[model samples]
Target: MAAKPVILQNKACTATYTTRGGALVDFRLQPGGINPLQFRHREKSKGSKEVFFNGHFVCLGNWGDPSAGEATRGHVKHGDFNRLQWLSSQKERQALLSAYSTLEGLYMERNVALDENAAVLQVTETVQNLHTVGRLYNLVQHPTIAAPFLDGETIVDCNATKGFDYAFPQFSENICKTWPCANAFDGETINLSSPDRAYSSVFSFLVNPADEWGWVTAYSPAQQTLLGYVWRRSDYPWISHWLHFEGELIRYRGLEFGTTGLHKPINEIWGKGLVSLLGESTCRFIDTGDTHHRSYLSFLHPLPKGFQGVKQVEVKDNVLVLTEKNTDHTIKISHQFKTKYAIQQ
Candidate 1:
């Protein structure tokens, strides 16, 4: 027999999978703990939580590598990847274990399996809390994309007019030019060519506080294809942008989206009221206890000649709309209650 269908294991990795959802193809071990090599944990720890696309490092936490000479800037940390800290409490550990067991397969197979013939690899993960107490915290999905796939030739075109410009302060004196569009504020979108440009990241996508959702695309000009697509939903409103192209570290770019603004702590931005509590309380807090779902679908498209234009896409009332002039594509990905949780006091 093919070695009981128990969770797959190897010397450097151990992971579970979901036959119903083709999720988590791999969960490799790192020095700290298990990093979801497929789809990393979203918070602030960077790749400490997950790595994707064989080389696409999905840093589920905040900030790039601290030792990579970029620590002068600020990076926030949420409770998502603090497994050692959770080990202190039995209840907390059990709750985390339960959540892990439910989504283990996603980390093992879906993240590690590379189907050379396939252009897109999509994985979905859901975590539900059966406990009665509320859960307070911040969650984010970080994916560190490689430089070869997103180098100087890459271009990002968001249908929206406004975005957060990260190359400010450093280049304000010499490279201050009005943004191309009406909504391109001075704080949105930055070019990497400017001097004094320490680093460039975009964090200005306003999401729905009730159910925030957005997508990030990584395309390879040489290959004339989209490397990946990361779509997420949450109750938080702020999104963070991180771009890295210097130092001895891997030359990769990252566009992280989340519920709160970059550089602001979750507790401070959401306030003590919004924090997910373990117990029931009437205090002011924003509870995103409901099921939050995110998925990444990789697709390969043929390179068209000068195919640069704005593509209008949105998910409204559960319907995904993709419009480009008269050519439009629509897909429906609705779940009844795939993942559920509650925020207690």
Candidate 2:
């Protein structure tokens, strides 16, 4: 059976989710406007093979490819979560989706709630071990942002100490820990926040040891709007910067936040002293009937013109604060829920 799409909305936004893999296909502002998220980066596929190029999807079980010819062992690229089906239901401003992946021996459930007349999306998710033995898993939220919302004048603001190129060994093996500063393969100092500094595409991490919480904000001065995400570091210790660009033909960045820091499979990441890049390790040993929970929140707020960048963003006393990086401009928003991560290890 074809997995039907589920829609949830409030006054400020509308979200669409697919029962297959529980991917959020669309999230846009109301009453009607373009999706803040980009989609269909390429033409249709010619076969049954799937592409991770969708607007937004979740990666699980395995962050990357499985071991060679291990399909019989339920190994699939990025996990079967995106390849499996989920059961869904909704009530008013909230929606619930749940599924069981026999391949991964895990059951996952997600609840999304949109507050009335608010521009916030609260997401809560739980993962349970259904198998008698333990298993290693990787989970990431892949939200790629692109045009009419992305431009060279756009700015990325976040607090991270060091950065490492994910795939380019020439750069990864040598880049400095000065953060957002990297020596390209050609000895050029590239600014990680610049959308135009891409070199053959790369995967990188915003390495941090924050146990309280973490956040990253993207400001589109062109649209006079800002988008951001807040999560707990104990649940997700790393934020990944995915850069890909080739002139006007393609340019998109994945402000990815998730469990594992390394984008490789379990074998490459498990017990390999890869924690520096693997972000806190999504590798967990769960016996039968054990459950784990992780949650995060996303928001889209309008910004004033000429807002170049942000210097600080913190959820203090349930108030979201944004202090401009180079000026005296500041924006504060009061909300109901705290930005703190609910479940702490």
Candidate 3:
């Protein structure tokens, strides 16, 4: 039998994490509000099959399709963490879960803690290589949002810079394009910040090298609510925008940020050697017995009447300040993270 899901609650929010894949199955504002992270249970039949992409699950070891040899060997897409069970325990408003990836020889531990006075969740993940040899790995936070909260009017905001379409034959900087303006599969340019566009594609953008922080937000005008995430730029330098629609209607949107943006295999990313153009390593390296840590926060803010989308998000004195677009209004939320990986002042 599978273990029970862990529930963490505070005065401002309630979060539920399932041990099945250590996925954040549900997160909602206090007093019964609509949960925006409702994306769950979709069958993925490619490579090793039987895997499902669910709500807010971490893509460990890798991001996309494995090499042909790796796939033939029964390797799953986006790593085995999402397809395997995890050990979990919770105390009060915090939950701790751990899972080991046999294929990657890496052990990952995650700590999910909720703020007592705000609808904020701080997630810290640490991975240690248990193998005897050094290896390259990628970790992506895949927080997908779906309907009831996601629609044609939803607006996405971020600080991403130059980016490229994933359909490109190779990951090259020569084809890099500015953010919010990307080439659709139909050979037309469209603004990627809105879900109303008539295209289904993926785009990746690099963070400004000088910026210490990176953030991505999605606001639902009709719902009068917004969901956002913030992380250290040094930790997660790339954000991938995935838009899926059906017959002029939006279906799902993925606000993914992580160590790697390229969705190819290890051989394709490292063997191709495009670090000079990326200005950063496309894959992270970990030696035996060494551990790597990353931290990020997801929060929900109640939007006021006549409020616009997010124009800017900043971390100011342990608080998350969001400024509205085309307006001077700003919303502040408590964002004090109790972890060593917290962003420094």
Candidate 4:
């Protein structure tokens, strides 16, 4: 094969990959528009990519769009972009470029995979310190699914209690929350049918400590298919949930996985666990630093007619355990069934 862009499609779905950034620019299910995905840039000059599934938007980002700003901006304050100075110069750009190139190469090597039955699509990426110095970087997975699947007919069920209450002033209180627990499933999943009329776009769910392996799932009421994501925890520590209910933009829900809380300081949080680079010394660009890998699996399951039951999904023990080490290493696993389901049609 000529190593062309990878494109996976079947009777039910389609996904497009680009080697430039090893990004999923296009993903869609048949009979599209259920979730219309769009990518936007804070600076108009910055470029972006919009991914759609079933006509609904799933993910969006620069995806090798050179126009997108090379620097990752932090939380804005008082209409100022001060916190974004982390990567403001040529030196920082060069460092980021080196790290990003490594990630891009991984994406090229292990970008997309389809299950044997063709019922799932898997995306994988690995990050290795290519230079002699260590580097700090930010990574996030932005996946959006249709909200009608949950709000209209289906419901979201997870093993969580009270929802994380967001106290931040900049974001919408109803959209985001601060989770006390480090793991998912401890945070409550948003119930679209709540009578309190309190609906949140951003919330956290508790993942089984055993499954500390990361993942997100979406089930369809009409199709009786469950779309699940099983990800590696070493690369992504946190997962973010987003829903678009009242906007004209698009009717959808998002399950974003990442290294830190969205719109929050992840490096600080991960640094406490010694997983993320903390200070300037740890951010040096050296090949002698550590390497990490994150994998995500997406698959579909056919639900029996009238199937409606909640089941406790457990994480694979071997998959979630992490060994503490002062040096870098590699972690790999073949994880399955990380996504639970309550099929109702």
Candidate 3 global Cα RMSD: 2.2
Question: Over 4 Å off in model 1, which ranges?
Answer: 1-118, 129-133, 159-198, 207-213, 228-239, 247-250, 270-298, 314-345
What TM-score does structure 2 among the candidates reach? 0.87
How far in Å is the alpha carbon of 172 misplaced in model 3? 4.0
Q: Using Cα atoms with residue i matched to residue i, what is each candidate's TM-score against the true structure?
A: 0.47, 0.87, 0.94, 0.53
Model 3, span 1-345: residue lDDT tens: 768899988877788888888888788877867888888655653564777787899888888877777777767778888878899888888889999987889999998888878889888888999999998888888999998889887889899888888887766566677877776545677788874357887888887777788999988877778889998998899999888888888788899998888887888887787543467667888899888888888998877557778888888767888888898688788766743454321
Candidate 2 residue lDDT tens string, 1-345: 686788888777788888876877777767645565775453222233454556677776766676654554656676778777789999887899998888788898998887676677778889888988877676787777788777677788666666666554433345645556655556566776654554644445554565366778887877777888877767776677776667644377778877765667677665466644523454555567878888877777877678877776776776678788778577876656656556834
Best by lDDT: 3
Error of 1 at 136 (Å): 2.8
Q: For model 1, how big is the CA root-mean-square deviation?
A: 11.6
In TM-score terms, candidate 3 sits at: 0.94
lDDT of 4 by residue, 248-303 (tens): 33355665665534333324333444332211111112134455545566544444
lDDT of 4: 0.38
Best-to-worst order by TM-score is 3, 2, 4, 1
When summed lDDT is taken over every stretch of 10 residues in candidate 4, the lowest stretch is 77-86
